[model samples]
Target: MGRNTRKRRTPLAAKVVAGAAALAVGGGGLVWANFHASAHEEGPAHHRTRSAAAQVATIDCPDVGQQLSGVPDRARGEVDGELATMDSQITEAYQRLATTRRAQAGDPRFVQNTILGPLKDRRKAIIDRIQLEIDRAGGRADDNLDQLAGCQGRPAEQPQNGDGQDGGGQDGDQNQDDNGNGAAGPVADDFIDINDVQPNSRASENGLAANGDGGSTGTFTTDCGVNENNLFNSDNLIAAPGVDNGAHHVHDYVGNQDNDAFSSDEDLANADTSCRNQGDRSTYYWPVLRLQDGTEEFDANELGGGAEGNVGRILKPAQAELKFVGNQQGDVVAMPKFLRIITGDAKSFTNGDANANSSWSCTGFEDRQVTDKYPLCPEGSQVVRTSNFQSCWDGQNIDSANHRDHMAFVQEDGGCPNGFQAIPQLQVRLVYDIPTPTVENGQVRNPYAVDSFPEQLHKPITDHNDFINVMDEDLMNEVVDCINSGEDCQ
Candidate 1:
């Protein structure tokens, strides 16, 4: 594959040279005096100036050359190899910083303290480690340390001219900046937007009154056992034996002791469950919601530098409904083992299309919906979010290309589509006691969001659920009987 390289723009040489000259002179004039005085007095002055310019040109900020110069000869090769990878690392860091800065544009302190501060610290630590290695090798630190340090103090430069065009030209050609680089495009307008999202129309205008007594058949419920296996905690199930936390985030698991990415029909059939019913060993789970209480438990992975380690508390759903939505005759059947079910779109939270099925509300104020914004729970109330997964499954396939093709939402009338058999629907609800934001020290702070989940995740409404049906035949029969009898059994 061909590598895509951006066109290198040489900075104005005079400006760069002048800046270096000023820095050199200010730092005790050791190298500056030698170069300046020699240039003025010697016939080869022009040549020396050219040499100095070349040297200055080589000094890229976070200068790898200077960093590697202090390493022992034997270790230099390995050090150089590692430094080569830093460019991509730095690039990735800039991308994340850009996303965070855009997302938290309203909260300057959050951008500065949470995002930029940690990034700067990490960069400095890297440089310091290199300096330490150089010192151990008995080499002096780079003479350009002052200049390099200055670079660290400044923010990463934003391209002034993109694609060699002005951003606000008469033609309204706004895609590129003056330098011909692509523009960042518009911000997302989703619930995560923090500024734009409003209450769901269906939920806000016509209160989400509970479904009353209609279509009550073929519905069964179970109180799955809840566990404390978080995404960051090591107790969570591994996707595969050798991969560590391959699932990325944490989930609360229930049923099927052998549930994992590699589990087979036999494994699921033989495994025990955490549910109240031993025969119903289906595996159901969702990401763990953390309470952001300034504690280590909710602390995001600021030091690790990734989106997976978010810090925040989980909120419970105001209402949750679980049922099988097909086979009107009330004949409930066992779901196939290894069946993968996913609910609530993770991408929708930030993509401007928050799912209507996913809902957010306060405990005592269930009639009011607050999917777009975090609600301020009352003194004794709490916040909750709900996720409802599709229940109609394609009997022939256990999985699909998108992890969703094999299963689908029920029809508007609550019936399964032809060819898609009805399976037990899983509904998940989360609860949180955290309060709303309060002005602390002149800044808007979310009391509930002490330590939060990843900033990329946007908010708690992005909640999703996954399940793998692994119930025994008798258990499946019992579930069917419970649903067919038109009784709400938990």
Candidate 2:
């Protein structure tokens, strides 16, 4: 009696016709009064009818790998072929607005007057012609496109009444519910139609191989770049004002002065780095895997609204690994500079928890399947995700109480427990080239999505990560003398 406490049935004419199209779409008059005040109330089912204009708007652009390293070289092939057609129209507008249906997901002003205001005015005229071809090849135009074509407009609900709760309370057949609680009604789609699920054929048993027993003793790399910073805005700084303050969704930071959250510890040991070792200012972060394209352009501050917090756009990760797995008798140490760790489970997309350890694979596919359901990657190969952390810690908490009780998860031939201590086992790896979700007859249609929070839809295994060791005590003793001299430094 828990999966949100069963009991279903209620579409109330798709929530009174999506609350009368959000009061005929005029700033959704408080989503037509919270959809008739939760339309007859009920409990649990992870309750959520909160509306502040139904909360959506999220924009974060400008990190197409740091704008292709400031493009120069005579406009690097027309700014990499116009950022490959703007990442294929931002992954086909988030797969047509997350499969829109629920009685036309109540007007967020008709998805901002027809799809993200014309893809944010055609991505601000293609970042103003790639910032005039990177300022005529002199570079440094820093094309942020006015903070990635700022956006705003929410108000879209009514589609979650299969006892999964969320459909203006209950009342009879849009599907079923005679009270036995079998639940199965409002199907006019609300989201999560990653092509009716099933693709993860199961294969990757943690591929990335190379633990090679012998109790590993080397590896301490750190490239941490491209994911500049935009911790879902909430006033930029880390988890502002405390207790995971503003991170409603959207992440993509990287090391040290992680672009604010009051960075300290001497401001991340005097920050400044994209790490090829400028003394490894360790910070690292996650989230932000858009391509859902229903116009929330990877949202940031629409429902939470501004204060300079919800900045978006920041992709780049065709390849990124920041290894650190030591101790074969090496006794690695020195990671306390403001340490704060977290890994996987970002609400596992509303606690459905499909075996969440945060992973999704596809490179030439062999079927990986670990949950957040993913597949469709054939042509050339793409779509990857991996978030592995927890290197033992607990020599006096840097964070715990469910931020993962002081960390621990190493032994499976990887070692490091028995009163936890060995740090340096963080892995991130994300790559998404895009395109490959078109099957049709047997149903596949993907359009890559994963920048959640439209009532938490785009799952992709809720991949999560967040570290902050800001190395440098002689570069953390040169990563503990290159992992106790076993030597495999990158």
Candidate 3:
């Protein structure tokens, strides 16, 4: 890995303690910095100059795939392929957006006329194709699909000067600013000190009285090694089946070895397992974390890597804990084989946070988590990322047209809603031993970020996890029995 030869500042611990009071924690334990009140007052003059002149940061487009539903089974493959094409179109438009900053500066409507217009046209064509696939397969296409073709250019969010370390709070170099290093995102404002975040309770942990007696209190743990095999790919079988580079960013895969874009249920069932238990062949995967210290990974020039703005040294997790917890109301039923569940929204950056479920924190500051901002852990503390999957199943469908209508999270009162059945919740907790990022001269060096879609700019809010329940019926029953008996088992 290559790092810039810059003088380091005082230890991060001291700065964290200094700025502990000014920051406030938000949902899922990630802290959201109050830009005006928290941005350090003594940042360089360039920070203020850059904030005053905002530029187009990224392209924001409505997720067309999320809008369509009830596609026939026969058309799913074609519809998914078209949706993947739409993603590639967005990525291409974003790359142009990043490189055409000069052209944008010269013409006020350059983005609208040259970039967004063509992108919208391409997207409209893809959407039309998707509609044809659905209608041709004897399914009614949604009438509003054409409305989702348009996209808007979003100005870079300004980072306010704040009261902490050099990197803690400053101008948002979220655009093509020199400080941003052309990465399009993960500016100084994207991170906050873990010490500054206040401890917040998770919604799942509160108000369980409606569910009665914490049913199925036992847990089933699986010992799956932390992807030592280095199984990495950009394929998302659940979302864009049969489409290569569907994810746009690489994912760290564990469990089923045969999992990929072209993987069929039969292929997955016959795949080798990474779990200690032979019966559990489920596939579990999430985006790989990377340190942006100018290191050239093997995929540096690949579609899901540097070409898509996911440049960095991929960091293997020190610990990857996968556990199945019980529901609050009652014993969980066995999840059907080949059941696919996507926990968080991968395009939450442009799509909005309605379906965001990512959580980031530090080892010592576990109580204080942040949903949107990455945590800057103090010295000796490690970084942590967690995804709590949906625990309620529809009891009929193993998958759905939109991939989310088949499962859901528990309600505020801790019970499954309506007809949804309680199912074992898959909880993934990943910990990393990363070097603390240092800020010098108002630029963040060696910043760590999760791989994301090119247009997302590596926002932590877009972090997500994928799961496929390939466990045999016997193993699933054992898991349910273990939970119902209130005994933890591996």
**Candidate 1: stretches off by over 4 Å:** 1-218, 228-243, 257-266, 298-308, 312-333, 350-356, 439-455
Question: Residue by residue across 226-326, what tens digits does model 2's lDDT show?
Answer: 65544443221222211122344456666654444334456566777577778787767676554422222333223221111112233456666778756
TM-score of candidate 3 versus the correct structure, residues matched by position: 0.84
Q: Stretches of candidate 3 above 4 Å error?
A: 1-54, 159-182, 201-213, 440-442
| Of 1 and 2, the candidate ranking higher by lDDT | 2
Scored by CA lDDT, what does every candidate get?
0.41, 0.46, 0.73
- Mark the regions of model 2 whose C-alpha exceeds 4 Å error after superposition: 1-113, 120-126, 136-210, 214-266, 270-281, 284-323, 326-357, 360-386, 389-425, 428-456, 462-469, 473-475, 478-490
Between candidates 1 and 2, the TM-score winner: 1
Model 3 misses residue 106 by how many Å?
A: 1.0
Candidate 1 lDDT tens digits, 340-434: 67665433322333332556666666555544445556567766666667767788766542355667766655566788776656666666655
Best by TM-score: 3
Output candidate 2 Cα RMSD: 17.9
- Candidate 3 lDDT by residue in tens digits, 1-490: 0111122222222233224312211111111121221112234554333422233556789988777778887787777777777787777666656544445545667778988999899888888888888999999998789999999865544432332112221222222232434354566767888877878744543211222357888888998899988899988888878777778889999899987887878888889989999999999999999888767788765667766667778999999999888877787888988888998899887787778886899998888888778899988999999888888899998887888988888887678989999988888889999998876655666789899987787788889999999899999999999988888999
